[model samples]
Target: MYRVWGFITNYSLLLILGAVIALIWANVDSHSYHTFVEFPIAEHFFIGEMHEGHRMLTLHYLVNDLLMALFFAIAAKEVWEAVILKQGSLRGKKAATPLVATAGGMLGPIAVYLVLAMILGSDTFDAVKNGWAVPTATDIAFSYLVGRVVFGAGHPAVRFLLLLAIADDAAGLVILAIFYPTGDLAVQWLLLSIAAAVAVFVLANWLPRKLDKGRELRPNSTWVRNTLGFWPYLIAGCISWYGFMRAGIHPALGLLPIVPTIPHADRAFGIFAEAEKHLTDLLNDIEHKLKTPVEVILFFFGLLNAGVEFNAIGDPTWLVLAGLIIGKPLGILLMGAFAAHVLRLGLPEGMRTSDLFVIGCVAAIGFTVSLFIAAVAFEPDAMLGDTPVQAAAKMGALFSFGAAIISIVMGKLFGVKKVEG
Candidate 1:
């Protein structure tokens, strides 16, 4: 079974599975299930031995707010590596297609939403305006997985689409930061950002000093034998997250300052490349131990919370879901095909117009980013309580899932295959 999907198995499907379980649990009449989602988990730990330790702590926080920040950070890592260091980096004209798609996808949703708002009148239609920007996205991890499965290596066009999808995600993140950050921006928090930037720069300079003599950062020569490369940055990331949290900027925003300094091999020379390979291995181990757990735990608990009752799917929510799941695919495919044809950019390799439509359908798996948008959509001071907007977002994600299923069916019916680059 794992062989069938490969690692696409993770990402959104895992979260979606949890949600389905929650819905099923909701439909059931079991009282035992109530305690899990309802009862909050309050856990904390000491950093040192009983003699000298500080309490690292937690409480009833929103999963989307904190843990998902880490996901954003991790997702940011992938996109950053691409745009900054990888071949996919879009400087100037290279960014055209994804940039176009990003703008259109986001704006289209707002247009649809505003039309709904006007039809329903401001009060009713505007309830989820924060979510207006929700649909302008394509989840990269999931999209890459889907592309790998449906589009083989021969398909350069589809492969490019996958890259475009990832690039679009990065753009979406920027959009979220610019348009979606709630309320007045805080100066002191921005100051903390500057401080964090300074601290990371200081750390990067100190990396070589911590190394041994006769050893350069090049391959076969390792500078991190002294624990300077990975552990220090990982701990810094934790501290950075905490500080950003307290400083009132979204904690995930703090990740931007620390990455330029992650100590990946900078020298393109051969000896340095070998040493860089070894250092990279060490860094990977460290990231797995430190960062991966942060992301994983956050996801698990987030899922546990989602263990809430799902049977309550009502008319308003279901309709919103329908719009997201159904409307999004239709809107994206029609728009994308027109763009491709009008511009004379060919279809992704091994892909046809039908395939692009299917890809658009699957793009709506809006689990991660959509969830974040939902959490922020309603004003904390609003009347219907903390959840109406959240419910709408969840519905939209569900609708997206449904649309993806339809896309898969369509693809199978039409025979979408991998085309060589």
Candidate 2:
């Protein structure tokens, strides 16, 4: 029993369990679930008052908008450490393939979604058209889980999938920040956000130097460096998040700009040259510290957001389903193949060209970020002004579960053996 508990807690079983409970609760008593999520925690009206004084936020808003910022931050850390801080990240032919594959993975789904939506020629398709970015996200956790089962824990294919997912996530972040907005752009607020990000960068660089000044005074104490390092980053991150929110952008993107500002230790290999390091860069310390809390956040995230009504299914559902399960793999494979031929890039050791398909299939599991994009894409009070359209896009996100199952089956068919480590 202890071993079982350890395994579940260690491997994000709590998060999966939370999602399951959400689905069941949503199906069994959706009104109660909706009420729970909508229940307001607090509210505040500014002295001048805009939009009813920012009404603190419901449980749903808190989870999706605020808490998810950390999730995006963690992902951003991975991308920054790999593509930016790492040596030889963009210089080599070996690094070029996955970068190209990431591009294909993103564009492929958008193309599939647009083409299918155009062919459908329905008013509903037109209403939810912004949802093209929904399926473009690849959920790293679920895909990695599937990949471990199919390719063994140490397979190069699994590593390839991780890199692909990371790159896809970076693409998704750009889409979320650029494509979705709650209102007209507030240029001043956007500039403020940029300033806040720069402030974070400056602080990140400056704090280490300041702490070093005290290091000689308290030669034996690690406390000075550790305590000062974290709080300033947190404060700066909060300022940055607020700037994005006021800028009329999704606050989740707030973390991206600031991530590159965080100090990263120099590394010798390309981003994909070594295995995905769980804890290598100093900039990643924030993500490492928040690992367990992030899991909890993801739990509530799933609970609050995964409760879409199945009856809301529409043409967007099929479009999303096809775009993810079919479009993701097709795009990744084709683009990867193209890069290999055009650039003379090669696959990772022990990974074949055929393995790319299975990797793509596993990459199709677009659960968390996909749902977040769906929420933004078919947001309420948008120009369309159709509540059902939002629900329909969410249904598309919910349907991504089918894609997970298909990936597992596809892996087996593609001869990816489950070798125990």
Candidate 3:
């Protein structure tokens, strides 16, 4: 998996290239657009007949529920590895670059969005305007490509930037689950879901000790056996996610159980024990099976869901673009620098405060999640003018990506090239 990931990182351009090709094909091929809705599960089944949309496993649903679970789980695994398991293993110096930069990058965008929301909240335009926060997203693959590989891996700053970017993504997922999910939920489903969560919680707390069965006392039990002690928790988490979905909440919320509820490390191994040797391996297998088809499903939706049939980028387009491109970097850099200083967590070795200004600029390259929020935030056809919110989101991401690149080049002239120790 590490080799495969490295390969993916090394040739990220090709993955993107493939995505672009798929996107084009999806838009052009009518059959491709319906791919996500095609997977069948069931509805009101008496243990026999198949259902299409009801109990069916659609493409979009699978991507959000199953694949993204692994995505979040894997991310959790990475955070565990970086800060704890691999702590200071890197040449006897722990890397604070990503952890610091990511916090600043994330908080900055959220701050900008909140301020905008407050100011815009008084009017009906608030509905449309509240989405400015949507653009603060930083795509990890793109950011990693630009920061680490494109910028050169030798730069310690780039590695930190990548970590920060991933952390930023984790933050975004939290915000989305909290702020973006639909408020109107089916109460019965909600109750059932809660009931399930409680059940899982009880089982997790009780079952682990039962499974331990004096295993911890045995010498040379091996970490492998400790993992075997965790199956009940894993099973419980799966049940939690399924229940959450039935309860009218986003199923992504289900992955939450896998963390706090599941015991990744034994008392002896401690929480900081790197699960990479085992946990990542399990997640890697799940990720391999899940990511490909989910990607395909989202591509299908992107094509058919392109409701911008008659829209064109216009005046308001320029306004949103300005917010994302101009607003994102300035907000993130200022907040990040302030926090770092206040917290006594200084910048990376020889990296000046000004370099983050460019990093801040790059952070606004928000397309994927922005489009997601736009899809949920706006009604079927509420926004006025030629461009729909969906189109605006795509456009905003493009503008931000373009502007971030420009900022990167321009920052070199004004930013300190090297900092004196």
Candidate 4:
């Protein structure tokens, strides 16, 4: 429990603080808040949002586009380890039902969001249709915290929730990369990102180990590890980021290619396990080193992205909320039950079928990533009547905290028995 609270405090508390400040500031003085958010840090910068004829770096752009890459890289690292490691959580028969449920979690939101939009009339549907991916996000940190509260530390549903959230994140990344482009696609620039990944993997990682293969001392690999450390990868990451920016993909995902290139432990202790911090592999080392910086990045991310005015609440807002609150549980319940019973994959021991709905309620708290998706989903100028669609959609993401209460209530109503550690 202490570990879970600590993780939340370290990663989420600051973000909440930032969000509270932004909400207060935006409501009190929206004009000033907007000015501050768009304040230019640099004009005609080599890397930033294109303004007029040249790139200009704003505080919002700095936090959202540049620094946020670290946050996503951390996410990518967990996903990579979960998929690649020998004892990974996302492997074998144990993960089949949860993986299938993850698919439903995502698909359900899209179906609900789009269907509701269409019902609201074609104009509203066309205005907000692109934002379908916003509600599919399951903020891993907040959802995990809420899950523990509802299900207790010993519940199998808690682990199942974490698995679903992680898989949702992996899928969310793919959605962002494929469905949302920052600019006109320039396919050729992606070659630079690929080249950087391959070069770093070979020159910094593969070669050193290859040279020390037969040697007991492993002097060459040791030299690289001790002397050079993370520099090579950092340089490669910068190159990849540039490539992503030029290639019109979200730059925040640039570090993804580099994450797999880093040396990692052969076995993972799971994302929330305390044992993970003790791992000395380069991947873990980089993640630990990045913890503080990523926390700060997330703080600004929340502040910059979550400043929708209270009046901005409109159709898109209800649409996003409906998708998360209504769609998530039903989707998970039906799909998870099918996978467990129909497919014969089965739920984890001690977890009842009814618990799947409760887990879905917990997973519906899509605060962070949902906010990000909303920001990228619509143009700043895009509007539904007088309300900005992006701002309204972001408001829905913020309101997803309501799902925490819904999860707790559903947990009790469904007669879920808490299993304490």
RMSD per candidate (Å) reads: 6.9, 4.5, 6.8, 2.1
For model 1, how does the per-residue alpha-carbon lDDT over 330-367 read when each residue is reduced to its tens digit? Answer: 66566666666776554544456766556665565665
**Per-residue lDDT of 103-154 in model 4, one digit per residue for the tens?**
9898888899999999999999999999999999999999998998999989
Model 1 stretches astray by more than 4 angstroms: 1-6, 10-14, 26-63, 89-95, 147-153, 182-184, 205-225, 265-286, 290-295, 298-305, 314-323, 330-355, 379-386, 412-421
Candidate 4 global TM-score: 0.97
- Cα error of candidate 1 at position 138, Å: 3.0
What's the CA error at residue 248 for candidate 4, in Å?
A: 0.7
The TM-score of predicted model 3 comes to 0.68
Model 2 TM-score is 0.85
The order by descending lDDT is: 4, 2, 1, 3
**Residues 1-421, candidate 3, lDDT per residue (tens digit)?**
1232443443333434434554454446535434433444432321222233234454444554555565455455444434444342212233444455556565565555545545655452454564644665776655554554324445555655665666666676677665655434544655554555566545644454566568876332334334544465467667766665654456766665455443333211211223333543333334344445545544443433342322435433454565556666676577657655766667776566776776666566665555545444444432231135445545454445575476567456655353212
The best candidate by TM-score is: 4
Better of 3 and 4 by TM-score: 4
Candidate 2 wrongly placed segments (more than 4 Å)? 1-12, 46-56, 87-91, 207-227, 267-284, 381-386, 417-421
| lDDT head-to-head 2 vs 4, winner | 4
Give per-model TM-scores: 0.74, 0.85, 0.68, 0.97
lDDT of each: 0.52, 0.73, 0.51, 0.90
Instruction: Kindly report which residue stretches of model 4 are placed more than 4 angstroms away from their true locations once superposed.
Output: 45-52, 382-387
